[model samples]
Target chain A: MSKFIGLIRNEHMKTFRRLSTWIMFGIAAALLITIAAFTAYYAEDSSGDWRADTEQQMQDLQKQVENGDVEAAAVQQDLTTMQYQLDQDIAPVQSDSLASYMESVMYYCAPFLILFIAIIAGGLVSTEFGTGTIKLLLTKTPSRFSVLTSKYVSMFITTVIFFIFFIGFSFIVGGIFFGFNGFDAKSVIFDNGETVTNNLLASTMRDYGLNFVQTLIYATIAFALSTIFRNTALAIGFSIFISMFFPTISFILSRYDWSKYILFNNVDLTVYNPGNVPAVDGMTLGFSIVVMAIYFVIITVITWFSFMKRDVTA
Target chain B: MQKQPAVEIKQVTKVIRGRKIIDRVNFSIYPGEVFGFLGPNGAGKTTTIRMIVGLMGITDGDILIKGNSIKTSHGAAMKHIGAIVENPEMYKYLSGYLNLVHFARMSDGVDKERINEVIELVGLKNRINDKVKTYSLGMRQRLGIAQALLHRPDVLILDEPTNGLDPAGIREMRHYIRNLAEKEGLAVIVSSHLLSEMELMCDRIGVLQQGKMLGVQQVHEMSSEQTQMVSFQVEPLEQAAIVLRDMGSKKPEIKDKQIIIELTRDEIPAAAAKLAKEAISIYGIQAETKTLEDTFLELTGGKEIV
Candidate 1:
């Protein structure tokens, strides 16, 4: 077990040793600041205080209605009622993307950040073949499983540390500007045109926790891709493309329902919010979670086995 | 004394795609022995080494370390071994000591003292503090050997151990390796492309060609079972061989047209000095000795160097 952990620690050191990793840390910091700046500067002014705006607009509509215009009076009464419902319907929807974009930046940042991690890490596995270092590693350890386990463990711990920084930095940045008080999801709109509201804390926690887990998942997928492809640039490109496009692909696949089991479909932590499930008759966030979990396990298991069995004499 | 067979490869074969990379190889190396795996480029030396370490699987047959199958007890078998395959692919960002420290933590029964001892043993005491990137190629190789020796395993396998080293560096490495084998009684298998170096260093030599084992012979036996060598120096080497051939010198190797012979004082003086008298300027007169390279090419028919 100590041996296994050492192997893991070795890989973790590789990440730590790279200047690019620090560069990624710097990039993540910059991206978080950018998101903060973007959120503060151009975000819709009616973001969290939507109901207040509706109320204010209604008062002005009523004043104009009262100025001797009977036709306007009837319109104001209906308009005010409509405004109240519209506020109830729209504020939460607006808040969800706003929150998700924040989560998206935090949660999916691994894929974006993997643009750096994968290229650095791609050589970690393939280089053993290229350089013949795998022989040293295998001959020293007792088992290939332990050898590979150590590598994954090391990468996981490293990713966990980065996750701490990324999630912490994102929340801090989001809190200072966006005000973390409204992180709850009041309502969420499903891709299939359905709606569910009032999942506040559960949804918020899910999104927040998934921010870290998603990075791990992205890392694992990128790792497997990097191993299979043996090229860092392709791995990074594919990881970014898959992580970024999976949700959209899932959204488009909602017309087919069967495509829901795709791994990319559920990477969106916001998909687990209150209302993002497709009305594909039998699908739920649980199913998406199950699918992603399967992909994660399968990719990981295959990666472990393949690396151990590989003939790294390139 | 031979403690036991540390590693044994029996009729092992490896095929990639449609080609046989390694074919029906068989050999054994005992504890407290320095076995040299010698071959030329692409002769499957690396492939065979990898197979023994279980970095690769045998397409057929078995590889056993300390009498345990590398496939089944691979993890457990590795606890008995240490190896370096090629260029020292260590964590470049970590200091040499940190790298050793980290590798030490993985192997059982290795501690800080052991780490420091191995660092000193490899003669990297002063530079061990520097980052691996800052270390010279020779320093890196020494550090690599330090990491491999940290666990004090029963067997140490080094692939191309002396690949890139200056004379001083190679001397340092050879001293430490020989010391480990003699003083500690550690079994070692070192691969080298330089046959003369192997002849000088290894107890037994395994000649490899294109992934096949041509022969495994003791170093003394290889040298003792003399092959034909011609060793008379001739000025204007080209003119000498041509004249020797014209004189019905069957299978004669005429360098500068000066003939060298295995025959001692009697047979050599007549042919070589006679050639000298025949206008091949005999600046130096000497007998020929069989070098490992000549024996290797002769036995394997220069099949392939891997």
Candidate 2:
């Protein structure tokens, strides 16, 4: 067991010691700062007249629903949220508030997180082969299974570190742009044809958690590709390609019943949240979890088999 | 009683795509001995080393290190073996100390002091903290050896260890490898195509050719065998050749005004006496010791070592 941890420590040392890994963190931090600055700059100073703005938004959404210019269900949901804000004496979350900025900015930052995690996952195994270090690595006392598992565990630890870094860094940046006074603010969500209120921190954490799951699946795909192809660039490129295009491809294939079985279609577990629609009519959160579990198992098997059974000629 | 062999390769064969790459090669390396694998390129030297190191699978027989089969109990068997398959390819981005620490972590019971000991042993103490990319190839090779020796396995396998090293570095490596075998009682397996290097470095050498083991012989005995080419620089080369033929020298040839005959060291005085009796002036009589290169070429059917 200590040997296993040692292996992981070795992997961590290898990963975190590289300049590219820190550069990834720098880029992520810079991007979040830019996003926070943009949000702060465009935020209108409506602190004293938020009630009137809420009433106007509710009226506009009601008109859009009656005219059939927008989907009635979505517009009605928005209208209900605004009406609840007015009745309950709760102000709508503004772009200048820390809670609202964090909740929204994560949605923008999730893709970059996935991309960075994919880069790390993609290079974890393939770089050893490229650098001819795999020969030295595999000949050690540990079995191939141990070595591969340590690498995967290290990648997972790195993913979690990236997540915490993103969330923490975004919090500081967002707090700097907007005062950190919205900890107890309530977020209005539309769930099951009803306006529901949730603590802003809880709701934002839920979004971040869901995004983390998405990043993990994508990182797994990249890691599997790294093992199979043994090329970092190809693995990372193909992962990004799949992440970018699979949603659109699944959308085009949504007309068919089998489209629901596509990994991309099921990867977005957020669609199974209370109010959002599944890409296919019947994909439950449970069903998506099972599909992802199956994919995770299959990828794990392929990766282990490829790593353990092959010769280390590289 | 003889000591037990540290590593044993018994009838090991490797078939890739229905072609035999290593065929029934058999050998055993004992503790306190430096064994060399001498063969031309494409002769399964690296493949055999890879099998012993558990980097490649054996199709037929098994390799055992310290009585543990590599194919069956890989981790247990690998515990007794430390190796550098080809180049000592360390992570270039890591410092030399971290590279040692990285490999040291993979094995059992290797601690900080052991890491530092290997660093000093390889003489990389001053530059141990420098990143590998800034080091010279010779320094990288030393770092590679440091990593391989970190775990203190009973068997140390180095495939083409002197490759890409300068002459002085090669000599230093040769001396270090020999010292390791002699003082540390480690079984060392070194593979190389350089015949002269093997002659200087190895205690015993196994000649491999086309995936077949020709033979294994002691390094000293290989060159100093019974039969040697004894050349007699005589005043009359033709008369000396005639004398050698009369003396029952098989296939005596005259070249460069000398009569050259394949004779044992015991036959030199008799041949000289016979030449003097035949009134042939023996100006010079030089016995050329057969080099490992000559014997290797003869064993591998004169294939180029490359």
Candidate 3:
């Protein structure tokens, strides 16, 4: 156990000592602050009482529903959600585009975090192989399994640390621009055209939690490729390309009945969000989780086996 | 009483992609001695070193280090081995001290003082805190040695350890290698194409060729085989040539007014007396032995050692 811990520390030292890692974090923090700053500058403040505005908007949507609009059901669901928030005495968020921007960032912009995390995971093992440090590392007392596990453990620790930093910094900067209010607000979504409600903060937390799961999966793909190929550029390039473009490709393929079984289709756990309709029919959170779990296990097993058996000839 | 060998490589073979890279090779390295692995390019020297350190797998046979088999109990075997395969590749981004500290953490009982001691041993105390990237190749090589020595393993394997070192650095490395064997009682297996360095550094030298072990011989024993080269420079070369021919010398070549012949050490004085008796004034007569290079060339069938 002590040896494994030492290996982890060594792996962390090798990774964290690289200036590129710190610069990546710097870029992430800068991005969050810039987004917060942009929101503060361009987002308009509420001109009147938020409750009254929500009530009026609900009435207008009700009228549109009564007039037999083409999207009457969705409009009606929106009216019901607005009425629920109004009845709860929670003033609707008052910014033009900055309302709950933090939650939105956590929800939709997690790919940015995953992108950098993938880069890191890709470089972790690949850099060691590329730089020929694996030769030195493996000659030590630790088994190859232990060394590989330590590298993966270090990657996990780095991911969690960076995640917390990104979230914390986003909170501070996001709070400064938009006051830390509206957490008591309800998160309302239309599930299959039916209105569903949740605590705003709770649902946002769940989204961020699930988002990390996706990041783990994406980072695993990058890491597995890195270890298998021993090339950082090829691993990062292929994994990032898949992460960025797989969804579009999956969307096109989902027209086929079996597309839901594809890894790309199931990786985005967000589609299972309450009130969010999955792009493919009959897909559920439980199903996506199961599929991802299988892929995760298979990839992990292959990577571990290869690392353990490979010859450090180079 | 006989001590067990520090490293016993028993019939180890390696096959990559269905082609044999190392074929049933066997050798033993003993404590308190430096063993040199001499081979031409692509002769599986590094491959054998890799197997000894557990960096590469053994296909057919097992390598034992301090009585632990690398094939079955790698952790136990690896605990007694420290190696720098090929070039000393390190994390160039890290400072030399940190690199040692990082490697020191892998094994048991290596503390701050031990790390400092190794730093002093490798003579890197002056530059231990500098980033490895900023270090010269020789410095990196020393740092690599320090890291390998940190764990105080029983066996030290260095493949081409002096590859990038300057002549001064090479001499220093050679000194340290011999010093470690004597002072620390660590068995050192150094693989190099530099026959001269190996001759000066190794106690026993093993020649490998085409995935085969030619033989292992004590350094002096091999050099002693060629200690009978006699060359005579006579004032009258024609008379000396005739005298040497009459003495039944086998194809003595005359070059630069000297007749060179190969004879046993006991025959040198008699051959010189015979040449002088022939009325040929002997200007100079010198006896010299061939270097390890000649022996190596003879063993490897004149193939160059890369």
- Chain B TM-score of candidate number 2: 0.85
Off by over 4 Å in 3: A56-74, A96-99, B222-226, B232-254, B263-287
Q: What DockQ does each prediction reach against the true complex? A: 0.54, 0.80, 0.78
Q: Largest lDDT belongs to which candidate?
A: 2
Candidate 3 lDDT tens digits, A71-155: 7756666677787777766555544233376676675568787888899999988888888888988888888899899989998
Candidate 3's C-alpha lDDT? Answer: 0.83
Q: On a 0 to 1 TM-score scale, where does candidate 2 land against the true structure?
A: 0.92
> If you assessed candidate 2 against the hidden native complex, which CAPRI class would it receive?
medium
- The lDDT, on a scale of 0 to 1, for candidate 2 is 0.87
TM-score of chain A of each: 0.70, 0.93, 0.90
Error of 3 at B80 (Å): 1.2
TM-score of each: 0.78, 0.92, 0.91
- State residue B188's C-alpha deviation in candidate 2, in Å: 1.3
Poorest 10 consecutive residues by lDDT, candidate 3 chain A: A90-99
